[model samples]
Target: MNKRSPLDRHKQIRARLARRLFVVRGWLVLETVWRAAWPVGAMIGAYFALALLGIWEQAPAFVHLAVFGLVLLGGAGILWHRLRRAIWPGDADARRRLEESGGARHRPIDAVFDAPAMAAGASVLWRRHRDHMAETAQDLPVKAPRLSLVYEDPRALRAIVLLALFIGALYAGPDAGRRLFQALQPPFGDAPRTVVLDAWLTPPDYTGKSPIVLHGPITANKAHDEAAAPLSAPVGSMLVVRLNGGRQAPVLLAGEDDIPFDTVGTVDHRLEFALSDPDLSVLEIRQGGRSRALWPLALSPINRRASALSEPPLKVVGKPCG
Candidate 1:
């Protein structure tokens, strides 16, 4: 008998590997589908529970809502696929056995096939599955969702590390002060700042002579001068910035956007020009035909500073502020 050459052996090995890979791939898909079913079912239950509890507080806004919706849809599809396979009548042996077994005498395999009997069996199985899942999940503390670098792709890890180093240099280097460059931006783009030079500031509707008239209800008072140290209101409030230049007109600001208006003593010959407070920064300065264009202020400063002792705002700016 002629012995197989090295090439022949290699080709044979490759063929076996290919067959094994195919089998593994098939098994992986089946396992993934099977495992995903329980999670999907649990999510469905949780979704309903959340709805009942009216817990939409932390739910994502518009963009995240869409993303979560797609995720749920994908989960639903996986669950449906798994359910179909689990309940499918394709397995001839299983189907035969299911048919032969008398209803209530033994557990039903597919409820769709024999509704009444399957329903009873399903109730029992559902109860067991629910209890099992609950007991298992009880001890496992809820994990804060986070990106685990351990599972990250090598290339992505390298790129992120490189980017982070590049960012670090901007802060670590001598040119750190350059980070405050964003502060030079105009409060409103190309819009001249309106100097309210009136003695009696009348807000929209002109109901009161108060310098500020908040249209919205105050929701949360992280800090305030009011009697309630931290007054929280369901509705948001409006902050009226009283103008001093003969203009009594008050600049109405939504409380939601207003950071604690820190009195920065005096700056640029004005005691209260709404000096660039570190707590608040201008988001956008849109110009309009009206006398007073809204200066969209952000509660968190873009170039937020940090302290060794305190938890500072996540700094987007590269360097330390002077």
Candidate 2:
């Protein structure tokens, strides 16, 4: 009826509506993505805080939380698909949409133009009506008026705020920020243990010489002095060993010699045992029937002078190591 093509006019108006619908749908999707990120960010921030505080002794719950977050995000993605389907308009649906969105001028005129489009086949009057619709579509503005459908939602804005806050908190604390995504580990390691065992060898009256005293624990399969010095003594020297300290006692004493260390002297908070030799390895100490730890010691004769010597397994009698 007019200079402009009717078919193209119908198509143009439909395309504009579809484009607006698409934009609205895209906005919904973007909003969904934004909203989904909030809870996920909250969960992630919580994990960082917990890890920094060393609160994950039993099992880290973040794995489950992250899974839940992914599920929530997946739900949003699925909703996006549903929203798209709703936004897409069929031919009949487009007819109704055109009528509703006809605006002021076309609003006064009845929607006879879209009547043929709603049906499968065209009638004699269909061309005339379609042409009129084309003219009407041309008169309307290019920009559609359903912008309200595509505006950012308040919920989405709130979600963005929450996400931003969570992200900011993650970086605010250096201790927490550095610990994110790091493996959870125990805080403490084995503490350094210091056990001191001291011993002395005194010759019997027959081979009498002054007693030689060594102060220190035996370790590495050898009885050693505190300064790691050597001991020189003749054979058959009575070994008098005294292990000082409340925590370094031995349940059973052992050595290469396998000689018996007899209980000899006792003082306040001290017990003296006569050892056959100065070389011994502490097998284990049992407190209340529970075996504890074991260490090594080495001992042998030396010249009158003590010198740094090679370490060896000791053979000393039972001496109260404590």
Candidate 3:
């Protein structure tokens, strides 16, 4: 045999390496497809489940169905081609002969040896490729797509919903407003408003008796006379008024002896009666027994004035809140 140059030996090594690399690349592509395809298949399965469960409104069900169909068809076609070669030795031979000029060039045992050797050489290349890929991945940075104000945030959606509600209410106007208010019931039945306090009011400077005053317009008919004595604290009364000023005031009526109130700890705003007389007025009040000076005792009708003029301007109400 003729002496071979070092450069020729190197070229031979490179040619063998290139052939092995081609095989390795085919395997890598196959593995990559297999790995990627499963997740897509899983995603498709999940989307199909969501569609069946009736939760596909968020993302169109048909899109997922179509993707699944296309991927299945593509994968099936690729698998069928690979299986055709694997299944029939004659088919593989014919294809190999057609590609390589009419002769069956290699022996079966030669292929077995070459296959293992190619795999071993490819393993080295695969390790290098993996290292290269890791280095490449380190060099790159991941980035997310930018979204404008209304596209991606829940707050924006909430704002839109609120705006829609306000517009709807504005269109429906007063009747809707009244219905909305009427629909809401107070925490307690319309009980006469009463407040509980930690202490009672101070006695007037001159008189030793603790004083209490009733404010608000007194109805001419419901003057709260002695005949209507022992007035029951009716339901639906709200403790609308509060008194923090004036330490001392005139007590409405004085009992002969030191009453349960005087003997007990400071009496908060509550019903009181003289020990001698059981028949007495039961006035509802704030913590210090002060009345709401703002509104009258009874609501007045606005027959003389228009409804719009009688009431304040309507306002948009938000989602039902307590």
TM-score of each model, in listed order: 0.19, 0.28, 0.20
lDDT of 2 by residue, 193-234 (tens): 222344565754444368877443233423322234334555
Off by over 4 Å in 1: 1-38, 58-60, 63-67, 80-87, 90-95, 98-322
Steric overlap count per candidate: 12, 12, 11
Considering every candidate listed, which one attains the maximal TM-score?
A: 2
Candidate 3 C-alpha lDDT tens digits along 81-166 = 55444422243432232223323233321232232435545876744444443332222221221123343243554454445556
lDDT (Cα atoms) of all candidates against the true structure:
0.34, 0.42, 0.34
Task: Name the candidate, 1 or 2, with the larger TM-score value.
Answer: 2
- Candidate 3 steric clashes: 11
The 10-residue segment of model 3 with minimum total lDDT is 260-269
The stretch of ten residues in a row with the least summed lDDT in candidate 1 is 262-271
